[model samples]
Target: MMKTPRSFDHIDTWVFDLDNTLYPHHVNLWQQVDARIGAFVSNWLKVSPADARKIQKDYYLRYGTTMRGMMTEHGVRADDYLAYVHEIDHSPLEPNPAMGAAITGLRGRKLILTNGSTDHAGKVLERLGLTSHFEAVFDIIAAELEPKPAPQTYQKFLKRHDVDPASAAMFEDLARNLVVPHQIGMTTVLVVPDGSQEVVREDWELEGRDASHVDCVTDDLTGFLQGLGAKS
Candidate 1:
C-alpha cells in the first residue's frame, strides 16, 4: 500500500507487461508455459524432468529468461524456443469487462511490453478481450530477443516507440523487471497475486514483494484503474 507516484497524472503512455500482469496470477496460465519450458529442456537435453526443471530455473536465474540462456549456452534457436514454450491452452483466462472498460477509459496510449512473443501477447489480449485497447505490443522478439530488466532492450523499445520514459507508467508482475523502468524515470507499479488465490511458482516471482523500486502494489488491476478517477 505504498503511495503510488503522484506523477501518475503526467503519464501519456501506459506500458503493461503481459502474462501474470494482465491476467489474474491465480488462473495459473503460466503453469502451462512453465511446464512446456521444462519439457522442451528435457527433450532437447535428453534429461529427466527433474534435471530439466533444475536447468530451466537455473537458466532463468542466470539469464533474464530461460530462452536467452538456452540460446547463449546451447545454441538453441530463438524461434524454436518461443514457439515451443508458448504452445498452451489459453482457455483458462476469462475476459474481464471491468478491466477492459477501465483501460479504455484511461487517457493516452496503451502498450504491451512483454518478454513473451508478439503472438503470445496477442493471444493473451484476445482472451482477455483487450485486443483493441493496445496501440502496440513490444515483445521479446521485437526487442531482438533480449528480455526485460535489460537496459538495452528498454532503450530500444523507447526509441522505437518514441516513448518518453518520464511521461510513462509501467505495470509489471515481476518487481525485478520494474527496476530498470523506474531507474529510467517511468512510474512503476507491481501487480501482486490475488490474496484469495494459491500461488505456486519460482523464487524470482516472489522477489518483488520487497517493493524496492515499486511505486505501487495492487492485486486488483481493474479496481485500481477504476479508482484512478476519470481520464483528463
Candidate 2:
C-alpha cells in the first residue's frame, strides 16, 4: 500500500459515509434497503414495482435524496419514509476486523455521515463490528432531510459538531458526494470497489471519480487507512 499523503496528517476529525463506504459493496446489504426504498415508493404512489424503481432513481437524481423529493412533491412524511426503507435484513453483512482495527487506530473523533437514518447506520455499524469506533451518526433527519452534495447539509454537519473542515477528512463511495466536501477545503477520499464487487450505481454518481475534487481513491479502505500509519 502506498503511504498516505501528509495532507491527511492534519485531519483531527474523520467523517465517513456509512453504506458501501463502511462495508464492501459485494455484501449486497444495501441492495435490500434499495429494494425496500422502491417498495415504499410503490406503496406510496400506488405504482408497480418496476415503475417505482424508475421514480426512485429519478428523485434521487433530481434531489440529493429520494426522501426529500417525496416530501416535496408528494407530501410524504420523512420519518415514515426513513423507517420503511430501512427495515431490511442485515444478516448478509460480515464484520471486517481489519477495518475495525484501522478505525480504532485513527486518532480523531470518528463520525458517520450518511444519507440513511441513524437507525440504519447504527445497525450497519453493529453488523460490521464498528459500532463502538464512531462517536456520532449524522443521518438524514439531522440533515433536515437534505442529503450530502448539498452544501447546506455539510455546513449543518460541521456546525453541529463544531468541526473545522480543513482539519477533517471525508470518505465516501460516490464521487459526487465528495464535491461539496472538497470545495469546502476538506481532504476527500473516494472509496471504491476492488473490481470484484457487483455494485450498482447511477452513471452520474460515477462521473467525477478522477476529478480534481477527489484527492485520493482506493478500493481497499482498510488498507488505505492502514497505509496512513506507514512511514513517509
Candidate 3:
C-alpha cells in the first residue's frame, strides 16, 4: 500500500546524506570503498581476508561505522583511514543535470551531512555536477569523527548549520539516520533503491522500513524534488 506522502510545505532547509543518498547505490561506488576498507582491515590487523571481513562487519554492527569501531578499539588514525578508503574512481558517476536542476529549484538552503570527509564529498559533488547546488558540506571531520545515527552528531549538525528541525527536511539512504532527524521534528525522507531489494550492509540499515520515523519514502529522488519544487 502507498502511504500518503508527508507535507513539507513548512520546510526551509534541505539536508542530504552524501554517498548513496546523493548518488544511486546501484552504481557500486561504495563497493570500491568497501573493498578498500576490507583491505585496510586485513593489512592493518595482519589477518586473513575472511577474518578481516568478519571484523569489518562486526565493527559496522557494533559502531555506526567501521571507522568509529577501529578508532575506539585499535586507536586507528582517522585521517589515514578516510584517505585510504575514499581513494577510488569517481568516473562511475555521470553528471546528473536533472538532479542538479531539481535541487536548484528547492527553496532555502541545501546542505550535505556526510560521514565522509570534505575531500571525498567534493569529489562526488564534482562528478555529479552538483558542486554549486549545496550551500555547505558538513563532513565527519566537522562532527569530530562521529557518524550519523548518533544524536550528538545530529545535534552538532543542526547547531552548526543553524537549522530549525521543525522547518527542515532530510533525505538519506539509510533509514536509521532518519530516526534522530524525525524525532527532532524534521521531515525525514528515506531514499531506497527502485524495484530492488534492500541492500543490507549492516543490521541497522535493514531496520526502519515500516516508515514509522520516515515521513516519506521515495525511490526517485530527482522526481520527488521536481514535484516538491513544483508544489512550492
Every candidate's lDDT = 0.89, 0.87, 0.89
Best model per TM-score: 1
By lDDT, the candidates rank as 3, 1, 2
Model 1: lowest-lDDT 10 consecutive positions: 1-10
lDDT for model 2, please. 0.87
Q: Which pairs of residues clash in candidate 3, taking residues 3 or more apart in a chain or in different chains?
A: none
lDDT of 3 at 113: 96
Query: Poorest 10 consecutive residues of model 3 by lDDT?
Result: 197-206
Q: Assess candidate 3 and give its TM-score to the true structure.
A: 0.94
Poorly placed runs, candidate 1 (over 4 Å): 1-6
Task: Say which prediction, candidate 1 or candidate 3, comes out ahead on TM-score.
Answer: 1
User: Which lDDT tens digits does candidate 1 get at residues 1-232?
Assistant: 5545535888889999998988988899999999999999999999999999999999998788999999998999999999999999999998988899999888889999999999998899999999999999999988998898899999999998999999999999989899899889998888998879897678778777656588888899988888764745
Which candidate, 2 or 3, would have the higher lDDT against the true structure? 3
TM-score of 1: 0.96
